[model samples]
Target: MAIQRRGFIAAVGTGGAVGLAGCTGLGDDTGDSDNTGPEISGETLTLTTTTSTYDTGLLDELNAPFEDRYGVTVVTVAQGTGAALETARNGDSDVVMVHARSLEDEFMEDGFGVNRRDLMFNDFVIVGNSDDPAGVGGEEDIEAALTAIADAESEFVSRGDNSGTHTKELELWDAAGLTIEEFGEWYIDGGGGMGEILNQASMQEAYTLADRGTYLDMQDEIDLEIHVEGPVKDGPDELMNTYGIVAVNPAVHEHVNYDLAMAYIGYITSVEGQDIIESYTSAGEQLFFAEALSEDPEFQQYVPEGWGSSTDDE
Candidate 1:
């Protein structure tokens, strides 16, 4: 299915402060409304964030403890970064947690958002079968690895769903001077979310790029090994994969819960929030690394003095 940009905006209007009592299915109703319960007079907030964080089970760890401490409930709508950003732009969501730095900057520059803050980060990796048919294993350079994959005509599954992850992958391929047209047959655009793309890659025994967090979370279900990592895995100047949070500008859309949204952003960037992100792990492996907001020079260029730390590890 094509990513639903409009549905994301509409979904934000449906949020409430109630904690989901069960494993609410991805598309299930969230039980939120204007007068369904107590007015959002307290600290409860709604967040529209990326599917990568949600799929990897990081948000739950961050939100559960936060709700108890702040007497607030965080209702999250997990979608592509573009969708999440659109939701914020439309004032359907209070805050947005997303990875596409360039897009996030545009959102802020366009006045759809404010108080854009840097949060935690993780890297993306190229995974493949143990046999390494594409011979990309252990390659320290991403461009070279991708070139080898294209030259070898190995199966490469792509999440063509226009997600932040997908956007990053396309950027890397473009940077390699290898257009999608040049590697047509070998590339399989899964056109889905991260988890589904990983599943397809495992089934095909193909090479695919994935965020470290999602791959670690679903590692048990796949046989692929991390063939490329570190700078090659999205931490060089070009591959830096940063995640940020922004509160939608109340001026753009009146329905946004501005105070609650800012609170969510503030809490996520706070020492306690960073601590929660640092402590999140899957299968004994750390999913994300916290970058001190106070220490980053690039963060200073985009954010105010006390917004929060931004992570560009990926």
Candidate 2:
């Protein structure tokens, strides 16, 4: 059973809040309202999203209701944020939902997508062996923690998949005035998804940056500890991870399903969809927060009550 969506916000304090499966051209498959009666079944919408959501099974939970409601099958192609965007750029997917903000911007400017919408958010956490070899445990300053890890030449694992987590890891290294190359053998690139890298890090006892949701979901099977994460309310500001969705531009890729893709964008950003995100949990812990419903300029247009500032009336 799911929790009540409104109460989820007050109860969890999630920093605030906030598919498609088709391969056809716009309106070629998932039909419009006019043809809704007889042709509503078995339409496909291909969704390309990130490891953070995919690894934790949030994608399945989130899409199940949406897929059943529309009678549309959603084929999820999961990878690091960079790869997911690349899949959309090549016009292989109908829509994208990923974390890396700068890459999302580049994707839009390069004419890959439109109707980009802020979806949801969950911060990253630094996980490591409980031994505290790097002495980074409980470090309030993420930069300092990273610097300490480098200075000690402690074993550190990187997703190295150009993922949003990897992107954030690189940014943290930059902020720490260090580089992975300089760390030499102490730093290892796992070149895999969150769960794989986390498992590798656990076996090797290395430090790594992981989305909190994924870490929590996989924690039972691993021995790693949350070495450097604070409570959501007090977590490092720089660690905040925001996820967004975009409808692949039909103009750039003429064979894309623009209409159904937009419906997906609309569905996930709507109150019901955001609520679905808020209500989802495992072991009684909510995996994500609904930032789309917040009063931010980027998301205001999508908020139902006209409560926030709308940048494009969305």
Candidate 3:
């Protein structure tokens, strides 16, 4: 069920890697109606996004102004990038915001979604106890760090929910010449959000891969510290975490609101939207870079007709 809130969006960061919440702004009566409850206005738009956005409170910050200006009640179902893409594939959401490029490409190629646009980027970090049991602290190479953690059996937590971070973690492990199936007792399949897995790691005093922003936001609540911060650019691409927004193809589900979804896709890549993302910070540090503003060919994509952002009309 969607969490109903007045102008404020509720914190639905949860386990199981999937949850739906709704934020109604000025004069918004639309809710995440199961269609059993009161029928919401046609202005309601559904956004299936990643847990990173919610855990870092960036979703609330970015979506609040969108709701306020458009008077659209944004019904959000947050899940891992994989699960969120699955939601869009099942025709259960209007838009999908996630970071797994391979999965996102698969979805688009298979005709499950359209209008994919690169929005922002952040890097992944390996974090663990202050004691650095895995000896991964200050490590420059992610694969080597994972090798150390696996070799030492340093009690690691894997988001195993197949989120973007989890995907990257697995890739790193494979590159480290190890398979998750080979992981010993030190490895745990954390079937939850980033915050949940981090909490578990904190309780177990284990190590885990995490997004920089969420970890920073929850540092006080957890004992984990950044053991490694991959460069968002000028480093190996595996370390980069680029987020994208896509409109769920209505052809797959006629019930979906394609127009509103396109509107959101447009809004997120717009100059104003990019500015909002750029301004958001945690602990006095910018959490995400507005990649939409970058002319990087890899970040360029097709924006909906009449909706491409003025920031970087790529």
RMSDs, each prediction? 10.9, 7.1, 10.5
**Model 2 off-target regions past 4 Å?**
1-41, 230-233, 295-314
Clashing pairs in 1: 15-32, 16-32, 118-309, 118-310, 241-314, 293-309
Q: Model 1's lDDT to the true fold?
A: 0.73
Q: Which candidate is the best by lDDT?
A: 2
Query: Largest TM-score belongs to which candidate?
Result: 2
Cα lDDT of candidate 3 equals: 0.76
Q: All candidates' TM-scores? A: 0.79, 0.83, 0.80
Residue range 7-54, candidate 2, lDDT tens digits: 222333322322322322223254455543234346788999987788
Worst 10 residues of 3 by lDDT: 14-23
Q: Between candidates 2 and 3, name the one with more favorable lDDT.
A: 2
Number of backbone clashes in candidate 1: 6
Q: lDDT tens string, model 1, 212-231?
A: 88888999999989988844
| Candidate 1 residue 185 C-alpha distance from true site, Å | 2.4
lDDT of 2 at 127: 92
Q: In model 2, where is the ten-residue run with the lowest total lDDT?
A: 1-10
TM-score for candidate 3: 0.80
